[model samples]
Target chain A: MKSRKTTAWIALCASTLLAGPALAESHGMALSGDLRIISDMSNPAPRAVMEGMVADFGEMHPDLNIELTIVDREAWKTQIRNALGANPPDVVNWYAANRMLPYVNAGLFADVSDLWEEPAFEALASTKGAMTINDAQWGVPYTYYQWGIYYRKDIFDELGLSEPTTWEEEKANCQAILDSGRKCYTIGTKFLWTAGGWFDYINSRTNGYDFHMQLARGEIPWTDDRVRQTFANWRELIDMGAFIDDHQTYSWQEALPFMVNGEAASYLMGNFAVAAMRDGGLTDDQLDFYQFPKIAEVDYAEDAPTDTFHIASGAQNMDAAKEFLRFVVSTENQTKINAGDALGQLPVNANAEIGDDKFLQQGFDMLSNNASGGIMQFFDRDFPAEMASFGMEGLQEFMVFPDNLDDILARLEDARQRIYK
Target chain B: MFPTPIEKRSRAAQLSYQSLLPLALILWLLPLLAVANFSIKPESDFVNGNYWGLPSSFDLFANYGRVFFESNMPRYLLNSLLITIPTVIGAVALSAMAGFALGVYRFKGNLLIFFMFIAGNFVPFQILMVPVRDLTIDMNLYDTKTGLILFHIAFQTGFCTLFMRNFIRALPFPLIEAARVEGVAEWKIFWYVVLPLMKPALAALAVLIFTFIWNDYFWAVVLTQGPDAQPVTAGITEFNSQFRAAYHLMSAGSIVAALPPVAMFFLMQKHFIAGLTLGAVK
Candidate 1:
């Protein structure tokens, strides 16, 4: 099967090479020397996708020796700095938004703002804002997944509740679900980042995208009235006993059973949870999704964290690296890589067709059209790492003990002051 | 004194002891038993929170099949063997010679030289993590099987030397003297006379070091990165994907990774036990 795919790809490549002289010239110029790529897509499926892309690109330009090293995804988080600081690769995998702040400030990541100016990159405008820092683009997004409420449709149907839209309706639905002797939501704060999702959604929905980005950039203090308002709104649900009890003890996957067993009606999670939910035996009719309900009169600012690729500033093959970045974000490659059997996420290219999954369609539509406010890269990616760590601990504390709002806010305020400086 | 045997206790006490012994055993082995159970469970069982329950369906072949056929596990296991066998042979060979010299000879600073070998064992191996990694990179040995093998031998030789030296010291001094009287050269004495007497100690130390090197996770992770060099201990984590931990696959992979050391322990049970008690009794 793999040989057949390679043969077909080779035939197509030959045809394209023969048919387009302009394309051949462009490829020839960028195909010499070597392009060293270090990817963190080390899972079996994504690893295959990365290798397949490299192989195809290598085939297109036989002279370009493509060296690909796939580091384990979690380990890459720490090893990236060392890998970049020393003998750096031409291209590397990273995330979009403030997560790139350190590398950008250190001048380790090369600015790819010129690529964004090209007409081909206009297809990837949805995530352009996320890739921008200091009014220049640093990388290009390859894939992203939306964060929202994945609820037990059967439980909601049995209880005769519709998906809530406004904050009042969301509270009403939670109250109804609570009355039915089931928790309204299942969340695990043991690892603490899960609580960051709650904060991003509530905080973004309360004060719009700009204010939330300001808070993420440490421009607004954690003790601000708007930040407190976001918590006060969240406190209503906590006081109503809406979340599963003893949630602090469970990891995110551990919290899945509450919804799977019908003890909880909903989970605020990313699109990846659908696979696990289906594995736990929820059919399409039994499961559903909805954007987090509006709290105040702000535009919907969804959390769609994008995974991206950036060229090293110390790259030896800058032209090849730039061309490879273009290859990664191209409509054809984006669609193929993010297909249902591949990444199973939304492709960033606007012209690219998404996978035929129910949630993917919703997420693609939501991010491309409905999210007029802006895209958030989730809290952990949006905030500086130190502040995010301390901020998540504070968020988890607030969820458990809402009365310690002042103390948590003060601590986060201190962390923000120290971290941002 | 040790507690009285259950057989010697009163009838009621004996009955209670018999009943509680199995319970205590199960309680102690619960984590292992759970891992065993998890290895055969379908992935959905974990998702459904059926952690302690019987598997909904038997997936033993499916899970282990993926680990063996579809993953880098076989290569990792092969790396483990390549790493372990060489380290065991290298460390044992070097230490055996050092032991013979320290045990049989009266060289200058002999006690001090032995103390240096013993002191190497005292420094916590964790503290060596950074410097050892830097050393490997400096030697251009990082992420190679040779690097891991060399480090394992270097680190493990310290403990193995102490064991071999003491075991050699306990051998009769008359043996070497007898070999000398027979006009045997010194190297010949080590090979023909002393090495023959150290057979049990060699077997015991080889078994001990084999398990140590096979189960070494910390240095394996710090020194190596991918399947080309990483042993099964570090490579077992490859079962975890970016977003989800494949608990079933990981459990199966772990069982496979653990098999070599477990098999060694069982097959070399006598030597293993002797390795534990050899120096202590002396």
Candidate 2:
């Protein structure tokens, strides 16, 4: 069937070649690799952005002809295993941190550390840490967006409140909001990953980014004092009724109804949630975005999941893959991703042209200003798939039954040992 | 027909049946109605908290146009057709033979052979995924539409044979005997005698297999990676970004994807109706 499709394609190519001799001119192009777009990256706007970038690369390199493959993210998780186990694609779309670590360690991902030394990539130095395993950079990150607490600007104005810069102030604000008969923060744990967002913010705020990173890597035991401290803070928020009721029943999208309808004031979410909030009929003036409130006096690292690209270890076209990677992080191609109805991400290249969307600009400011400390990919991204799946479930279990924390931790720790071993 | 037609029932019973028919259909079609609702709507209707209300604007052309021109829905539809048609043909053809052997033959292990096909139906598909994928990869058929079609044919043959065997068994055995007594060859008896009478069953089984393979999402994803073999069921998800889901576009793609099977049913309406009403009339 594939051969039939190929034959049909060749037939069409032949027809086009006959109809227009100019089409045959680019047949000299030698650079080709399969650049995959997995998950939500399979979107039309994003895919168009990527296809445009690929076309742009063809114009720039003359010999570049990368075949862009967009696989549904759900299938990619399993398809990737088979695609890699046999003959890996020239370049594949994958996430940063522990997600990439296993593939890199197993020599599935080609080391592109030399690309790190390029002067054009100087601004992307912070993103490299997430893509690195054992001090060796394996991939080049292209897209990452901010994950922050999206609060009600109108509520802040009405209650004469200010954005909390510290954990105490955040708690105080939550208490004040609740005292006034409103919910403080909203989260939907139905999908479980939203629970990971709360765990991430709390862990990052309480124990600092290092501990959060360690916990994700299974380097820190789940039963550790610091891990307990993170949950303790989460428990306090639970006790304060900071999160809305029956959050376990609602997805993150479902949880937006509370905030959008004005029953809830704040929600710690990524920029993507902004699209949802607007969809729920909230105007831009009503909502304000802020970085998650500070906890202990730790360096300000945040959850910023970076979508990255890597050359396959078994790639038939290493030079083309490297060339494609270089083109991707270039200011031109990177800016194309941020252009036109595509604020779902912030381009990793600082030199890339930023779009004019205020929400996106705010995401840019929050990430850039807090860049003194590196970005950690969100929990699901920062951990291996199986471990991340278990972690999200553990977080969800905690949200549903906060008192069963110890049991959940022990179970996660057990899975951690089995998985990370 | 066995329960008796609604017209044969009492007035009050007929009234209940007539009243309940549309209600049951609507209930069954509620999810489909929602998809239809979403497909015609602009994205603003979803955001503005008016899901069940009349769409603010009818953007059917825009929505479906994007699905066809802007997105890969057409390619996916073509892929679905390529994969589904071949599988249905292969499964129905093979199962006709298998069902014949098991149903007509008085050989040893006839029940055992029929039971094997039935048992295959009971195994949960999830368990077969890994090994099936590994086997596909080993055979160098991984990521090809042929691989997906082959696996679908192989897996669906179990159900197909069960359906075919039961269907063939219900036919008159005297027809085959009469053909044999007329000095017709056994092969001719099976082909000209039995195959001609099996039209309704074939038509019924074809529609079932076509719909099953057409709507199949799991094997489409497992056996094929990209647009080369990925069918419309898995393809609609391309509108789903890791972040924001394009429900409107996905719905449009879904409607487009659902068109062929619907068209097939309509085109084969005569055969389908004839097959279903096999013993209805005295």
Candidate 3:
């Protein structure tokens, strides 16, 4: 009876050990507990690409599970702020520079410099400048997309219009298009950020690259004459009826069909819009690209600004996140992503090959030729997000009520002071 | 006879008002009608600017299928159900008990506690963000549906209690007195006598809670993360990002996400209004 009782106890102990591991497995791989990623990219193609990438990552690292949640741009900012104040995601998609600075200062992101030095990241070192703060690398660089004008080739040909090489010629071409009874520019400012593309290019053109940077850094006053000139040029375009009417009510996506259907001449957009334009049914033969017209200046460089990705400082699996970042910037993955519907994006790595898409290849050639004089980050990314918010609102007010430029400039100056302080 | 009887004119006016009712309803539902139309349209239709016109092709099923199959929409729906149903039941139950205590029993601080609940319901969620999240994290409930449900129940209990107490206070006190005189125990009086009479309140609160919780986006994002716990509203956002320019899919997804609450409202319109307007008349 003693032996039987002992045997029964031994069996119970063995079963309990077996059951614990089973329960863990049933709940699935949850290395570092639970992991989540949030981003503002909600379109299907990018989502499918990300989902596929995550699935592949899951297979390779069975002990780690990734959850991806997406929110609209407005909701994304609000949710991220709330989540950070509450329970932050393990990994998140956010902008680099001043955007990450506040979060890093708050001890929200993990430092991953050790992973940055790994062999897989050697090619990304060139782009890591944007992601680093106080000499510490905070996030991984996933995708770097370029910005340019995507024009309707068919409409340009029909109107006998060639890509303008200078700002004056670009305006003249727009005037001609308007003279011919076609909408000179098909743009939307419902979200207001769409108008910033115009401001970034014009400021980059008029003040040159370095001044644009200084402007973003708040070293220059908003009421400075050079700054006023940028708005003056924008006002000129508006007075010329270069922009579509009811722009305040239309989102970029909503205004896309007009460009696709040949009702409008051009869309000032980023490389990401290539996918959107194609999805709107424009074929390769029907699309063409050009740099935003350069203001005639001795100091200006030709390169447009860039968008970058960074690792969160608070990421639990910093090593894994770095590995993923390396994979993204690798020539193999960059080529694959560029070859897909998205175009005009240049891989940050010098050695990475351009994809088969002609527009993307041209973009690569432009990058290689150092045709880009100097890179300025996009306006929204370059400025403090809160200041950018007010700036965009100011742009809307300026657009809707053009007579209030002085008021707009004063309000912007006030916002800039508040943010910089 | 020459002046026309008052009853005859009243009858004509009533007939005219009834005839105009369907027309008014149609006018009110025009926006919804447009959305429903857009929900069924093929991608090509939207691209071709056929927004206000009849759909060139019907791809409703295809769009909805993509939303479910391509995204983790099934998981999202289940998560929403898990969070919302439990929140409704939990909030209603707790509020009912507290409301009874406050409404029937004349005790010190009764009005004070009641007013506190009323004022607390109006406080901005930002004030509660840090503490509530820290509490949930310490409880080891972060990122779980239970975490979301718990916060929702606690937060909603304020509004629900106020609603319930006011509702119960308006009830006849003679019913409770008669039950007590019949030698019924307090617990039994609540269970057998009062609860049955609270059916309308129960139904009304259930529908209101269902809609509120289902439509909640801010808390869904803050309290939950993975597909395992995120609700449909948050899921719709993820879906929107994934399919950036795919408006057809987005429209269909919106309709799918909105259906449950819409259906609940339609089925229980009378009870919903009765519950909402309970004290308004008084």
Ranked by TM-score from best down, the candidates are 1, 2, 3
- Give the candidate number with the greatest DockQ: 1
Q: Indicate the worst ten consecutive residues by lDDT in candidate 3 chain A.
A: A24-33
Model 2 B-chain TM: 0.91
Residue A195 lDDT (model 2)? 81
Give i-RMS (Å) per prediction: 1.2, 2.8, 4.0
TM match of model 2 to true structure: 0.85
For B201-267, candidate 3 gives per-residue lDDT tens digits of 9889889999999999988877776577889888775655421556677677778889999898899
Work out the TM-score per prediction. Answer: 0.94, 0.85, 0.79
Candidate 1, superposed: residue stretches over 4 Å from native: A1-26, B1-17, B273-282
Candidate 3 per-residue lDDT, tens place, A43-67, comes to 5555555666666556544666678
Q: Please, what are the lDDT tens digits per residue for candidate 2 over residues B165-253?
A: 98888888888778778999877877997888888889988998899899998888777865767899988888876666677888988
For model 2, state the Cα shift of residue A35 in Å.
10
Q: Spell out the clash pairs found in candidate 1.
A: none
Candidate 2 lDDT by residue in tens digits, A53-75: 66766664464545667765565
lDDT of 1 at A6: 44
Sorted on DockQ, best first, the list reads 1, 2, 3
B-chain TM-scores per prediction: 0.92, 0.91, 0.83
